[model samples]
Target: MEIKDKVIEIIAEQAVLEPSDVTMDSTLDELGIDSLGLVESIFAIEEAFDISVPFNANAPQESDFDISSVASIVAGIEKLVAEQKA
Candidate 1:
């Protein structure tokens, strides 16, 4: 599957929502993903894609980190993938 698809799948699974319920612009907060859920989702994404997302002290809330929308999450995943490949 494509990056977007993979991202949506991961979010859907983590947020306990149907894949159709998530859109490219859907926010994680809007989907009711809490802090722990966000962490779990991030870890799952990292493991799934074999990438590590560096922790940033100034980054947005866990749920907000590139998770404001599916598109953003896909972009984050792409970046992580690139970093891992590098």
Candidate 2:
């Protein structure tokens, strides 16, 4: 599956929703994902892609990775994945 697809799937799982319910423009808050869910989602993404995310779970606002939207999260993960292969 594509990175975006996989990301949406993972996020959907955390939100207890279907992948189709997730949109690139949707923020985690809109999907009812709280701080704990966000942390879990980040961990799941890191594991799924085998990449270390430079995210500060306790301080998301200070993190390098962007979690503003599903699209942004996917983009950040894609960049990390590419860096790992380089």
Candidate 3:
């Protein structure tokens, strides 16, 4: 699956929702995913893509990766994947 699709699936699993229920504009808050869920989702994303996410749970806003929205997270993961292959 594509990075976006896989990310959505992972996030959906964490939220106990279907992939169709998730959208690019969806935020973790909108999905009712707590901090622990967010961290778990990040870990899943990293493992799925075999890429390390530069996210800081304590200071998320200060991190290089953007987790503001599902689209942003997907974009960040795509970037990391591309960089890793380079």
Among these predictions, the greatest lDDT belongs to 2
Candidate 1 C-alpha lDDT tens digits along 45-86 = 888888887644346655334666778878978987887799
Q: For model 1, what is the alpha-carbon lDDT of residue 82?
A: 80
Candidate 2 per-residue C-alpha lDDT over 1-86 given as tens digits, one digit per residue, 9 for 90 to 100: 99999999999999999999999999999999999999999899989999999888778889989999999999999999999968
TM-score of 3: 0.96
The digit string of per-residue lDDT tens for model 3 on 2-82 reads 888999999999999999999999999999999999999989988888888888888999999998899998899989999
Measured against the true structure, the TM-scores of the candidates, in listed sequence, are 0.82, 0.96, 0.96
The 10 consecutive residues of candidate 1 with the worst lDDT sum are: 56-65
Ranking by TM-score: 3, 2, 1
> Model-by-model lDDT, in order?
0.79, 0.94, 0.92
lDDT of model 3, residue 72: 94
Better of 2 and 3 by lDDT: 2
